[model samples]
Structure formats: C-alpha cells, structure tokens
Target: MFTLKTATSFEETIKKSLFICHATPITSAEEALAFFQTYHQADATHNCWAFKLTQSYRFNDDGEPGGTAGRPILQAIEGQELVNVAVLVIRYFGGIKLGTGGLVRAYGGTAAKCLHQAEKEKIIPTTLIRCTATFSEMAMVKSRLWQEGVQLISEDFTENGVCWILSIPDEQLDVLSAVYTNITRGRIFEKIET
Candidate 1:
C-alpha cells in the first residue's frame, strides 16, 4: 500500500563475510526483480533477495540454502510491517563458510538493519470522483465537500457549469454524495467513484 520515496543501505559482518543490504520500496514484484537484477553484482558470492506486497511474496536464497538466507530476510521485512518493498542482501565471502544459522543471521540481520534505517510512509485508501456543479453553485458546492474531508483534485469550468474532480475516503462515499446533493439543492454534478 505504501512505498519508500528513497533507497537505503546498511552493512554488517557475519562470520568474517561482509553482508551489504540494499533496500527500496517498490509497488510490485516485477519492479523489485528488475531492481535486483540491475544492482546484482557478478562478483558477489551471493545476492539473496526478498519482497512482500500484500498477500503476494517471494524470496530467493540464491544458492545459499533452502530457507536460510532469503526466508529470514523476508521475516525481517514482515516483522517491521513493511509492504511494497524489496531487500537484496549481497554477501562477500571472506574465506569463511557461514552455516545455516550464520547465513540466516547475516542476511536477516542486514535486511533488518537496512530497513530500520530507511524512511517509511503510510498508505490511505481513497476514492476519486467527479462532481459537477452549476456555474452559480460552484463555490458553495466545492466548499462543503472540502469541509467534509474531501480532497479536491481539480476543477473545470464549462458551458454547463463547473465540474469538480475530487478524492474522498472510500468510507465517505455515500455521505459525500448525499451532502453534495443537499448543499447544491440538486444542482451539483454527478459522481463517479474510482
């Protein structure tokens, strides 16, 4: 529902190997995969990645193990209640083999650290509608909706009157429609919720 406005990174040492985690918010899994491929290095020993968007999710251990690397990283992301985000943990082997537990710590810890440092934002559900009003009723009609918490997206003046496009919270749809009618004495325009 929400996405980060910027990318962030973090680093850590695990069993002598340097694990660097790069995280960014993305609206879909396709974007996340594209970002991972773009930043994935041929020289890094492993580039494990994970992403969660609502009920959909995916993770890649990248040959590390069955579930040690990517799954734990996903857990870290979910633990923080993040959505529409991806975290790629790149590990540079320092001549040490980190067992399953160590790999989990390396990848999961790096993701947690990176996401913790990144900026987070909340998503609000909204409905977009076009409310038309007569030229004479424009101002009052618009004013009433604004006072009722409807966000005005834009307005247009035409031969018929002034048409206002606005976004209101989904829950307020019926109320907004009813109030607009009463406020304009049935002169306001129709509404299309999107």
Candidate 2:
C-alpha cells in the first residue's frame, strides 16, 4: 500500500464553477473527520469528501448528485492504489450548472491531479520491540540499531539496565533478534511488543 507524503491541493474551474481539492494523509476515521473540519469551506456550495483506510472507507456527496462527487473522489484514490488517505473537494457554484458527469469529472479529476502531484511513500509494516541492556552494552546496541535502520521510540534507564522501545520493520524481527544476541553475547534480552 501507498500513502501521501504530505498534504496537497489543487484547484480548477469547470463550467465557471470552482472546484478545490485537498488531499491529506490520515490513519483513522478520527483523523479523516479532523481533516474535514480543518478544510471544509463554510461558504462553498458543497464539501464533498472521501477517505480510504485499511479497515474502513467512506464518502459523502454533500448535496451533489447521489454518486457524482464523493464516489468519484474515492475511485480516484483507489486508482492511485492509495490507503490511509482523505480527500475533500469543495465547490463554489458560479451560477453555472454542471451536469452530473461534469461534476464527477471536476471533483475526481481535481483530486487525482492533486494526488498525482503530491509525493507518495510506501507503507512499511512495523513491529515494536522492547530491549533491556546493561549500561555497558548501550553503545553497541545503539550502533547496531542504527546500522539496521531501526527506529528508537523511547529509552528508559532502570536500576539494572536501560530499556529501549524500538520500531523495526516487521520482516526483520528475527534477523535483528539474532544480531542483538550476538552483539550482547546473549546478555541483552529482547521481546516483541504485542
């Protein structure tokens, strides 16, 4: 799956009506709703939107024809193979009436264009690992983690050692565990966070 690297936007005029599309990366329905609240234009004629998450998806036409605006935007996101994203298309009627087809083209095309223009990154699944190591082993563990491209989430000093929370690529857990064992000579203990 892919996701937007950053927020992006595009605007265009169709049949004298203004269409503005804003695309943002979102991980949950709450974030999607927050995006809508942040970007919805109160003065616009419509605030159509669509979102795609791993487990859920939704769209709203916002007074446009039943399937004209939001569904097309969702289709655009699917066409790009995007997940964890939300797109809002705001329209300002300019006294010109665009038929359903025109509305679809305007909203969907604008959203697609905006998304195409924005940067995208692959979604790498990750697993959290907790490691406890003696203070003397800290330097080596930190170096190994850096070499393996593991992200250190938090570090806590304990009476016996330091506890580190790390995010590792899910596919690399076994290899990393073996490497850690080797580095610490089986002194450091590691476990995957459930």
Candidate 3:
C-alpha cells in the first residue's frame, strides 16, 4: 500500500459549482476524524469525506445523495491503492445545480487529481530489534547501523554500554544482524515483539 507523502489539495470549478479536495496521510481513525473536522467548511453546501486504513474504512456523503459524494471519493482512494489516508471534499454551491452524476464526477475526480499530483512513497515492512553494545563499541555500532539505513528508535545509556531499540527493514534483518554481530563481537541482540 502507498500513502501521500504530504497533505495535498485541489480545487476546480465544475458546471459552476466549486469543489475543493484535501488529501492527507493518516495513521489512525482519530487522526482522520481530526483532519475532517479541521478542514470541513461550515458555510459550504457539503463537506464529504472518506478514509481508508489497514483495518477499517469509512465515508460520509455529507448532504449529497447517499453515494454520490462519499463513495466515489473512497473509490478514488482505493483506485490509487492507498491506505492510511483521508480525503475531504468541500463543496460551495455555485448557483448551478449539478445532478447526481456530476456530483460524483466532481468529487471523485478532484480527489483523484489531488492524489495523483502528490508525491508518494511505499510502506516497507519493518522489524523492531533490541540490542546492547559495550561502551567501547557503542559509537561504532550506532554509526554503522545508521549507515545501513536502520532507524535507531531509542538509546538508553547504561553502565556497561547503551541499550538500543532499532527499526530495521524486514528484508535487511539478516544483514543488519551480521553487521551488529561483527561490530559488537556477537553481543546481546534480540528481536522485540510487538
């Protein structure tokens, strides 16, 4: 799955109605709700939204026809194979009334355009590792791990050395373990279970 690199938005006037879509990368349902609340326009005719997560998804058409606004927006997100993302499409009635089909096209098209233009990155699987290094090996271990693209989540200094918590790409586990072993001469290296 992929997610937006950053929050992005698109605005266009379709059939005299203005549609504004804001897409944001989200980690949780709460974050999605917060984004919706923060971006919803009160004076606008409708503030439709949708969110896709790893475990769940939701959509709201606001006041538009049951499926015209929200479902199309969700489909747009899924069409892009996106997860952990939220999209909010705000509408300001432009004197002209667009039928159901027009509403769906405007909302979905705007969201799709916004997402297509935004930069995105892949989500790689990661493994958490906990290890300890001796005082003499601490600096070398940390530096080498960083060089290998390991995320050093935390480091707790202890009398003997430093306790390290690292986030390593799953594919690099074996290589990273070998590097850690070589640096610390087979010191304490353990996988942390979530």
Candidate 4:
C-alpha cells in the first residue's frame, strides 16, 4: 500500500556528457519496458535502463559493457526499496570517456538520487461488507465502528432491525468481528469478502 506520487527526472554531468535519468513508478514489467522504449533517444550513444516490479525485473547496459551500467542501476533501484518502478538513463557522450565501471556508478547513482528526491504516498485499501445486527445493539456497534474508522455507507431497516453496508480495512476484520459479537450477543452476521 505504498507508491510514489509522481515521476521524477534529473540531469547531471558525468565526465562531460549529460546524463538524464527518468524514474517513474509503474505497476507492471511491460509498462516499465514501454517507458524506456518511448523515452529513449535512438541517436544517443547509450540508453541504459533498469526496472523492478515486486521481485522480478531486468536491466540492460545497451552496449555499455557487461555489468558496468545496467546491473548497478538495478541494484540502486532495489536498494531504495522501490517497487513497480523503472529508471531510464540516457547518456549522450561529450566526446569524453568514463571507464565502464565509472558509467555504472554514474547511472545507478544518478537514478538513486532522483528517486530519493521523489515523494512517496501510502494507499489504504477499503472493502465493502454487509453487516446485520439487532436494534438494541445498534448504538454500541455504531460507536465502536466509528472509533475504528469504519464507515457506515448505508443501511436497510427491517423486522430484525437493520442490515448495514460498511467499508473496513482488511486487517481489522477480526477485531471488528469481536466487536459485533459483544454488541449483538452473536446475533450479528457479517458477509466475508470474496
């Protein structure tokens, strides 16, 4: 439930050539690769890139060297604990030379700094559920649920009292179930989410 709010791009000069790194949070591997392809300048001397999604990803030096460019950048991404993200580092040679190892450190270091500058946000998931309880138990249930941040989305009054629709966090289900039992003396029923 964590993700970056925006894509960030940064530019730096390493050994004369300008290095531009674009870092964006992506949900899938395909999206990551597509981003690299879309933004890469074909005429550039090198367009090295790295991406990671969950536990799987790949990086390519794009002819820089065996491990001097891509692998290090990918490591930097993982080291930052970033997920669903891609880093495309485009290098335009300035007719100067940085050894293969220098290129790796430059690409990865620049990308890591870009990500460090980006903002991160948390996304809390909510689920819909049906809850039923007797009339006498309504007050207690309502109070406890409100305290727990459960939203009473809607309700249907019936002979048995009220059937309510609510939104709750997944992690709070067990505690919420206990609250329902204490309120309705086990008369309450909550439908499990599929």
Each model's lDDT comes to 0.84, 0.89, 0.90, 0.81
Instruction: Name model 1 segments beyond 4 Å from true.
Output: 1-3, 147-151, 171-175, 184-194
Q: Stretches of candidate 4 above 4 Å error?
A: 122-173, 180-194
For candidate 1, give the lDDT: 0.84
Q: What is the alpha-carbon lDDT of model 3 when measured against the actual structure?
A: 0.90
Taking the tens digit of each residue's C-alpha lDDT, what string does model 3 give over 85-183?
A: 999999999998889898888999999998899889787878899999889887898777775557879989998888989899888888878998988
| Tens digits of per-residue lDDT for model 1, 38-88 | 889889999999998876999999999899999999999888888888999
Root-mean-square deviation per candidate? 2.9, 2.7, 2.7, 4.3
Tell me how many clashing residue pairs each candidate has. 1, 0, 0, 0
lDDT tens digits by residue: candidate 4, 70-176: 89888887787777788998889998788877887888898888888888766455667788767887777777776565777889999977788888876886788
lDDT of 2 by residue, 1-194 (tens): 89999999999888888889999999899999999999989999999999999888999999999999999999999999999999999999999888988888888998999999989999888878788788888888887765465788898999977888898887877777887889878844455756
Best by lDDT: 3
> lDDT (0-100) at residue 89 of candidate 3?
95
Q: What's model 1's lDDT at 72?
A: 94
Clash pairs, candidate 2, are: none
- Candidate 3 deviant stretches above 4 angstroms: 95-97, 136-144, 178-189
By lDDT rank, best first, the candidates go 3, 2, 1, 4
TM-score of 4: 0.70
